[model samples]
Target: MTIPPCTESGSSVLDELKAALGSRVSTDGELLQNRAHDRSHHDWAPPLAVVEAASTADVSAALRICHEHHTPVVPRGSGTGLEGGANTTADSICLDVSAMNRVLTVAADDLYATVEAGVMKSALNAALPEHHLQFAAGPGVDATVGGMAATSASGTTAVHYGTMKENVLALTVVLADGSVITTGSTTKKTSAGYDLTHLFVGSEGTLGVITEATLTLHPIPASTKMGVWSCPSLQHAVELVVKALRSSLRLTRVELLDRVTVDALARYTGYTAPVTETLMVEFVGDRTEVESQYARFAGLAAQFEAAEHASTSDPAESSRLWQARHDALPAALALVPGSAPLPTDVCVPISRLPACILATQKDIAASGLVAPIVGHVGDGNFHVAILLPPGDERAREQAEELNARLVERALAAGGTCTGEHGVGLGKVSAMAMEHATALQTMRTIKASLDPRGILNPGKVLAAS
Candidate 1:
């Protein structure tokens, strides 16, 4: 929805925001245009202004200014989201919180850390090495902690450590009317009242603007082991993942890459593995325990006809292997020059993973679309990145159709349309289709929290 420019009112609102924030406010055309969109393929609609919030107070003051003018405010982090969660329309205030990046407190003794909203995940982990503590939830992108919490992000390590929803203990949020409130507590367990912390965790900025977060941290692994196994087929690789997941191996991550993806990785990066279905597995614990886990994993792989077990315990070697997984998307994109990647993910029961992936592969082949498959198969989550050639509307249409069918297959298997990526503009229809009557309840919650709907309008719920 393109909101017409409120030239008169927008000028007043910008003036007011500048008055409140001085040099922090910006009405620069290029800056507003750039802040209006994220990594998604969504069309950009530039906001009226951009506010670089340096503190929680700045966020509150900015929100208050927009609230008084009945203007919409779209909160943004690093703009790394693949979905259109951070995209904005005209006449809206683009609140960039990246300036607020700061680690507030690190309670190593208590296994938690509090940070201002804009702290990047990699920076937090880097800061924790001296304390022998690390934030376990790892997304592929170096996203802001606030954005990770807002999207409830999970990645490779989530198969062991869990998602942002589990790691986050509390949050400092600035409500629509500039009211500040803290949700959750420092304690690990809390049943004191409504789980407001969770309500905003995946709210995608519809409920409030997250300013700070208290997150759970875990001790650095004493011993780390990683390996890559070659499988004859996708079915065998998935079977091996299920077998490993069912076992007591203390698995840290189990990722899968199809033959095409492997080829792409080999082409983009010098890291070459067997150009077949492969599983990258990791285990962390005491040296003896990690070795035992790898031995057991090797035995299971052998049963599934998986060969070429390349194992590593050295930190440098382990990092090199994992970097391949993190660089999967870019490598796949490199395979098809001048193509826009449409990445979508879904999660299903472990038992349904094989069938879901196989069927999706068949659908991709039938549509003749270029998509490479990769997944965190340990937890029944995977992504099908569709590479649509430039100016090929028909190919884009086919990819869209394939995506819908994949979602349907996942839904039929009792899974979500998205596992880690929240219901941004891309999945709003899927959310409604998946939730049915329950969606009304979510709308009620959104309405209650943001009455005027000035907070990130047209996202999560819809344009209505």
Candidate 2:
């Protein structure tokens, strides 16, 4: 689907967009170039213009106009996505919802909050602290609520709280043709029509644009504990985590950082993390519950030959440790100067995580690539940061081939190609292989919702 090049007559569409949206519609060269690509390694492709949508009406109107003119529209929020979901195409209009950053309502009693699509998860959490509530499904980065819902993201906390798909109770979505629909409801359950809210949650903007979301919130845990345990090997670390995951303990966060990642984080952050395969686990609950769970976790690790198990209740210390985990990607990148990082995520069954990760580590060593592994081992999801030179085609190809083989191995082990990172431009080929005939069903849905393929062209589904 090609958007016609701008002619004297084609300029009318731009005029209408500007006239309808005032200064919100911008064709500024610098802004266009800046918003071209996301954190993904997808090559830049600037949009014809960007519309800073401030309201659901603005989103509807913009989409209505774009729909009428057959202009591709790429919905963007915060631009923190590691995938190329928000990256614009050559003839597209970037619909940025960052200006719609408002928390519409917070029903503390109902344990839900309604927020505009552009509300960042960190901002919402800050606001909810007073109420002892938190929106827990965050994707590490300060991503927008709408974007999180779009990509179905989950992070360290997801093992306990759940993913965006589970946390999001409802959504205010603008369809491709500018029709507004409220999916789900303030009530917990509904025996209504299809689960449209979920359909759009992980659709990656190919179906519609989410303008607002009503999300389920959790009460801030009464007591929380953080601990790091060093294991003899990656397999030992993963096996210990799998035991905890299967237990009745309510673990809030369980992460694994390989020896390379641990070394990198220690060097970059000046924090003295154990220089070995490590498992970082956090438990949240009542005082007694947290203490008991932490004890059980330690006991389980002891069976697997745990080297060290140190637990802490200090919030400040816990934050410092988790911050190191968050900084792993950047720290690893710093390890290989002047190299572009290609981050890939895969999830396998808990029982296969050890084999999958071990095989990947060996594969990386044989390929001679400087890649470090980090993971939320509680959920069997892990990420590899492969460093490739900026313009080194051979290095990029090697990284790509490694990524493919890793995904294949994970798939054979009954896992997914991508765990949280949505299938943007980077994982299209993997999606084809992973989904097989089911990929056609996705294409059909994409066509049904966006017949012209004007919504996020060249995303999720491969170009047919």
For this target, which candidate reaches the highest lDDT against the unseen true structure? 1
Q: Give a tens-digit lDDT track for model 1, residues 166-213.
A: 899999999999999999999989779999999999999999999999
Per-residue lDDT of 239-331 in model 2, one digit per residue for the tens? 787777778777889899999998998788875866889988999888998999999988998899986546688888888778878899889
Pairs that clash in candidate 2: none
State candidate 2's TM-score: 0.97
Q: Least lDDT summed over 10 consecutive residues: which range in candidate 2?
A: 1-10
Q: Mark the regions of model 2 whose C-alpha exceeds 4 Å error after superposition.
A: 1-10
Q: Model 2 Cα RMSD, Å?
A: 2.1
Error of 2 at 156 (Å): 0.6
- Score each candidate by Cα lDDT: 0.90, 0.88
Cα-based lDDT at residue 381, candidate 1? 93
